[model samples]
Target: MTTRFDPRKALLALSAPVLAILVAVIVTSLILVVAGDPVGEVWSTILSVPRPRVVVSIINASIVYYISAVAVAIGFRMNLFNIGVDGQYRIAAFAAAVVAGEGWLPGPLNILLGLLVAMLAGGIWAGIAGLLKVYRGVSEVISTIMLNAIATILVAFLLRKVAFRTEGSNIISTTPLPEDSRVPGMAIIPDVSREVYGLLFLAVVVGFFYWFILGKTRFGFDLRATGRSETAAVASGVKVKRMVLMSMVLSGVVAGLVGMPLLFGQDHAYGSTFQPGLGFAGIAIALLGRNHPIGIIFAALLWGFLEQQSNALQITAGVSDRLVLIIQGVIVLSVVIAYEVIRRANVRFEQRKVAQALEEQESMTKEGAPA
Candidate 1:
């Protein structure tokens, strides 16, 4: 058998993305200087130890972005392009807020049920795309994109017609959810922000579960098999159609969870654009993390840190935050291209190994027969 890939080569391959990230950082820095801002001051602010509350917000933001990113990675692992997590998250939050507004349940239980509602709703929404792809051969990319537009429109219509129609608020949004619906928050570690600490605890749990589900479960294997080759999986008696549908549902559920931390964990009210475009960050986090859940945690933190510093860059380096946006876009695109290239190369290598093994078997058979 052909030797497996060299460990050093794999390490270097993994580091390639880090190198790109470093290069992007430098490029961003240079742009800041060119924009007439002082880089030194910006660097200082980014590295400076801040008071407890600000630190808490940063940690909270990191956890939020990281968890959402993990959700995105789940979909990507199954070969499903979940480009509409933004829509999924927003819609789920909307549903949670509606339930909260109705005051239909008690405190902690209401919060838990609201989260469940969001998770199920978002999963169902994404499942629609999965169904279309499986049954009609429609590309998920197209369907998910269309679903995003539909989600936005639906949210807008609901906000205007019912949820937050209070007097004189021009911006469309759902009304503030009742206090009882808020998820009880707590500090994770002593001396850390309570909210941040609680979120970190949740993050760890999610991370552990992510590993267990993807590594130890038969369902994960089926999903992987389907992603690698649907035809082969079907021949092996694995239900490829069901797996695809399940993948979308699972991914959507995770995306829905993203809404929970926001609605109950962070904000009690749901605004239309309260945190727009955060879901797309998952695409970057997935690529940067290489679709590994643990890696996504770090990648998400890095992106979050950069974003936190972005506003400081404006004041010190005179660079617009959009500069960060450009850099992130390029990074995501590069990761995607590189991932595709490596995947194809791996496939070719496997094919060659199979061919060589077959040839060796035939030669041995011939030699024995002649003897």
Candidate 2:
């Protein structure tokens, strides 16, 4: 069955996030004023045009964020919350770093090998939770959380005991990938010394696949069906357990790519200093984006922009960089509240329309029948 496009519905859907953002801005401004900060200066600093370097940084950061959000969104679509994305990506990255550091294969092949290993590591790590949920009836939330802690400990052990350290570096890290295996950054932003990530195209591809897989395919239909109602899905011949496992694994596979941009284009190795907490951040982005691929892109860009501007806020407006955190927290909360309010409003409108239609039908029936 084809669903016709409804512009009003689309507008209504978009309103929640927009309203939430405006509320966040207002709240943040009030907070600044109350804290004796220069609210106007803070606003100006955040809203001003960024330098080319900062733009590049924001774009790069958004790429990573977009990928992470996509990973989280996959599980969200399946009614699964794979919170261990942090661990999945970290383990996968360490595995990739270990492989790339070896340079056993020729240039391009080495890069491909590392990527494959990363996906495998991530899938296997997340699959454990899937297995537990399917066979042992363990809550994925609990299992994944436990897995995250274990993954951290395991990675730490492997880094110290198994992975070779880069020579002369104080930071404990895997051997850096060979020059040939490293992806060179693209000079997409002219006049900016900072180059965009070489793997920017990868994010595009991931987004396209995410949209297609979830919106187009039979598997996608079954996944959504199961998400909506497991009992009904089972009655319709969907394999709920298998879907759960596959969805979790797929999410982890994408999660594995979350670190690749940094690993290949910038960091070139997994290290103690590798960025953490992106998995948690991705959850917020996914929520903000409403699990839609296009919405996720905007949400990620907004998140990255705010993060990039936080430094400027601290330096120029003399506000603490932590102000951004408060703003972000408020935005997330506001989105939740806004969406709930909009949902209730929609329900009421629909109910009223149905009642009016029923009343008109009754009046017309009486006039035609007894008169």
Regions more than 4 Å wrong, model 2 = 1-3, 163-168, 363-371
lDDT of 1 by residue, 171-226 (tens): 55676777766666666535753556344666676678778898789988888877
What is the Cα-based TM-score of model 1? 0.82
lDDT of 1: 0.75
Give me the displacement of residue 230 in model 1, in angstroms.
Answer: 1.4
Count clashing pairs, candidate 1. Answer: 3
lDDT (tens digit, per residue) of candidate 2 on 191-224:
9888999999989999999999989999999999
TM-scores for candidates 1 onward, in order: 0.82, 0.95
lDDT of each: 0.75, 0.93
TM-score of 2: 0.95
Top model by lDDT, which number? 2
